[model samples]
Target: MDGITGETDSLGVHLHYDLGNGDRLQLLRLATVAPDQPLAALVPLDGDGLDRLEAIDRLLRTLLGRKIPQDTRLTPQQRRRSRHMLQAIDGRMNGASYRDIATALFGADRVNDHPWKTSPLRDITMDLVKDAFAMIAGGYRTLLRRRHRGS
Candidate 1:
């Protein structure tokens, strides 16, 4: 394991496994294992347990050089919205008005098609900006784990 290292302490061992392409896994080992034994995950049975397990599975797939399923990944539409959210947030920080941001995002034609005061794009742009601000303020951590249907 060229890229694997661990530190032992009173609490436990903290293992840092780094991959070639810049990805890294920070695993905590609760107990010592034999040299030839495989590592295992200790997941808590709780509301977010499934999401945590899925994240571990994804990490294992990456380490094993296997393909992670696309469905478990963010969809194209979701990715686009994330990109737009970041863009809108950046525009606002750069002193661009909501109308200007909307024009850049949805284009001048779509933004100009409706009255500025009542344009749907205005609302969309505002929501994106608001959501992005929340994300910047630590809400992005919530997006890391998949939520339950009603969660």
Candidate 2:
């Protein structure tokens, strides 16, 4: 596999190919197959079968030097929120308090417009930090799937 990496796991040897742009494509090498050999996917019609199929399709396109498709599960708002969450976490890790993080994120002018105890930015900053910590504590896997409206 050109520039691909492999890691052994219970599922099998997982071959990971970095797609750049913070995205990665992984293929489970379940059976013996050479990199030069023609590859095929045998996805069963299970709960996550559709996701697996989409990944396989993306892998095929990647191998063919085609553009990989973006995941439609995340909306622009979600992407923005995720980025903000990382920023909040980074600020906190750098010894910044919630108010300081809010100041940096929302600007000092807006943060100064209201009292610290009642500013909405304070609450938003808190939530972002909490969400980021949750992601670090194994909740990041949920990013792979979209959340249902009622759930």
Best by lDDT: 1
Query: Where is the poorest 10-residue window by lDDT in model 1?
Result: 28-37
Residues 1-151 of candidate 1 have per-residue lDDT tens digits of 5578999876567888897778777877766665457778889999788988898888788768799865444667877888999999999999999999999999999999999999999999999999999989998877676745785
- Each prediction's TM-score versus the true structure: 0.77, 0.73
Q: Report how far residue 90 has shifted in candidate 2, in Å.
A: 1.5
Evaluate all candidate structures by whole-model CA lDDT and list the values in order. 0.85, 0.83
**Error at 17, model 2, angstroms:** 5.2
Clashes of each: 0, 0
Give the lowest summed-lDDT range of ten residues in model 2: 142-151
